[model samples]
Target: MLDLRSVEIGYGIMDHARNQGYATETVGALIDWAFAFASVEQIHAECLVTNLPSISVLEKVGMRKTKEVDDRIKWILKRNSVNEA
Candidate 1:
C-alpha cells in the first residue's frame, strides 16, 4: 500500500525557490506515487478554510472537496475516480 498516509506542502520564499511550480510538481508526484500501490484506495488532504492557495493546489491535482469540519476543509482523491479532470 502507499505509505503516505498524510502529506503537506509548503513554500519557502526565503530560499529563493518559491512560486516556481515546486509545490504543484511535488504534490503531483506524491499523488502519482500514492496511486502506484494497488491497495491504496484513496488519498486525502486537508487545509484550513482560509488557505486558498492550498485549496487551489488540491484542486489542480484533481482532489475534490468532500467535507468541512470546524476550520478545516477536507479533500479526497479516489482511486476509482480516475476520470477527474
Candidate 2:
C-alpha cells in the first residue's frame, strides 16, 4: 500500500508520439496536478533501466534516483522541489 501523502505516477506514449516531447509534457503535467490539487507530499515512479527515454522524462520533471532493484530503477520527487510550468 502507498502512503497517503505520496503518489506514484506512470505513463505511456503511443508509438507514433514517442519522440515529440509528449512524455515529458505529460509527466510534468501529472506532477503539477498531484502536488497542486491532491496535496501530495511526494511522487514516485519506476522505469526499466534500459528505458532511457523514460528515465530522461522523469529526471526532467525533477524526480531523482532513489533506488535500483535489478532491472528497475525507482525515482522520487518531493513537493516544492520543482517549479511548475
**TM-score for each of the candidates:** 0.77, 0.91
Candidate 1 accuracy as TM-score:
0.77
Clashes of each: 0, 0
Residue-by-residue lDDT tens digits, candidate 1, 1-85: 2355444333322347655777677778887887787767778788889977778878888889988999999888887775656
lDDT of 2 by residue, 1-85 (tens): 4688999999999899899999999998998799885668999999999999999999888899999999999998888777642
What's the CA error at residue 64 for candidate 2, in Å?
Answer: 0.2
Residue-level lDDT for 77 in candidate 2: 89
Q: Estimate every model's Cα lDDT from 0 to 1.
A: 0.73, 0.89
